[model samples]
Target: MTQPVTLSVPCPDRDCALSLARAAVAGRLAACANIYGPVTSVFTWNDAVEEEDEHVLTLKTVAARVDELATLLQTRHPYDVPAITWETCSADDDTLTWLADETR
Candidate 1:
């Protein structure tokens, strides 16, 4: 059986978040995408510390889909260098099962 993975991506605006979330789920690039509320982000940009409030999304899917998912995200994302990060999850079996079944 293929192992599942989780992704956490940040979108600066609501429209972008909704668009990416819908596309990811519809295309099966991600099985699930949980859009979060506006959160404060402090990170370095252009060698300067910048602060911006942005929306966050948590996505879950299989490892086989990560490459395609990343491509889809980058193609439609608004930001030139948007955050399209993912991680392999090993939290628990139940959560892993849930992620695997999300597309269904």
Candidate 2:
């Protein structure tokens, strides 16, 4: 059985987040993408602490598509280093079926 996962990416703005979401869904790399934000993020970059407002993009896909999705995000993302991570999850049978069908 294919493992379902959610890929999380941080975007600098809504436009960028939406663009990535559309491309991923269109390309069949993801079944769905959820965009949320203007959330404040605090982190250290290049040896300095920084804070910024960002959007969170969550992509639903199977484990099989993760590499391709990550590559697509890297090519399309606006940031120098985009944060792309995934979490394994359990879903209902109907949701899993829908996700597989949509991504395929």
Candidate 3:
């Protein structure tokens, strides 16, 4: 059985987020994607504390496809160092089946 996973990628703006989501889904690297916008983020970068508004793009995919999806996001993302991370998840059977089918 394939494992379900969720990837969280923070983008500099809404357009960037939407572009990543569209490309991933269109390429079947992800079953689906959700974009949340204008979230305040505070972090340390370049040895300095920074704060900015960003969009959180979440992708639903199988573990097997995560690497490809990450590569795609990295290549297209606007940030010099884009934040990309994933987590394994348990979903209901129907959802899991749908995810697997869509991704494949």
Candidate 4:
């Protein structure tokens, strides 16, 4: 049984987020991608404090394809060091089935 996962990524803007989302879904690297907009993020970068409004992209896929999805994000993301994170997810059987089929 393949494990489901949710990947979290922050993009500079809506366009970038949408582009990544489209690419992931089009390539079947992810079953779906949810875009959340213009959220304020404050963090430290290069020893400096920075704050920005960014879009968040949430990608859903199975564990087997995570490496490929990550590679896609890493190569296409604009940041010098993009933050890519994911967690294993629990879902009902039907949802899992749909996810697996979409990704496959």
Candidate 5:
């Protein structure tokens, strides 16, 4: 059975996050988006681990629309190197059905 995919994007600020989220949902590239700000991230970059404060957005959508989501995210991202990652989910059938319906 096909399931919803979860896409995570790190944003430099709230405005960029909101724009990306709205575009994804309006374009039917994402079934839903959850945006949160003021996240503390500690990760590696340029061969070193670093810490930063950023906004995070998680987009839920069907697997088939992942490429669309990627393109939209990359284009709208504020970061020179945006952190946009996707993972297939194992979620309840009902939830997945709703996502499919709403995205259309």
Candidate 6:
């Protein structure tokens, strides 16, 4: 049984977010990618505090492809240390089946 997963990634801007989303879906690495934001993010980097607007890219995929999806983000993401993370999600059987088929 394939388990559904949602990967969350923060992008510096909208274009970067869209690019990643497109790449993953085009390659069938993800069933869907939702781009959200222009949200404000405040974090510390290199011993300094910083605040910036960023877009959040959420990808829907399966457990089997999570690692590959992460690798793709790592290689293509603009941020040096992209915060690529994911969590398991529960979906209806039909949605799950669709996700699996679309990804494949």
- Give the poorly placed runs of model 2, Cα more than 4 Å off: none
Tell me the lDDT of model 6 at 63: 97
TM-score of each: 0.85, 0.97, 0.97, 0.97, 0.87, 0.98
TM-score attained by model 6? 0.98
lDDT of 4 by residue, 9-78 (tens): 9999999999999999999999999999889999999899999999999999999999999999999999
* Candidate 4 overall lDDT versus native: 0.95
lDDT of 2 by residue, 10-72 (tens): 999999999999999999999999999999999889999999999999999999999999999
RMSD of each: 2.1, 0.7, 0.7, 0.6, 1.7, 0.6
For residue 100, give model 6's deviation from the true position in Å.
Answer: 0.6
Candidate 3 overall lDDT versus native: 0.94
Give the alpha carbon lDDT tens digit for every residue of 1-104 in model 1: 65778887889977889899999999877878888879998999899999998999888898988998889888988888887788886647777676667654
Please list the residue runs of candidate 5 whose C-alpha ends up more than 4 Å from where it truly belongs after superposition. Answer: 44-50
Candidate 5, run of 10 with poorest lDDT: 75-84
| Tens digits of per-residue lDDT for model 6, 2-69 | 89999999999999999999999999999999999999999999999999999999999999999999
Error of 6 at 84 (Å): 0.4
lDDT of 4 at 91: 87
**Residue 71, candidate 2: C-alpha displacement in angstroms:** 0.3
Whose TM-score is greatest here?
6
Model 5, residue 88: distance off in Å is 0.7
lDDT of 3 at 41: 97
- lDDT for every model? 0.83, 0.94, 0.94, 0.95, 0.87, 0.96
What residue runs in model 3 are displaced by over 4 Å at the alpha carbon?
A: none
Q: How close to the true structure is residue 56 of candidate 1, measured as C-alpha lDDT? A: 91
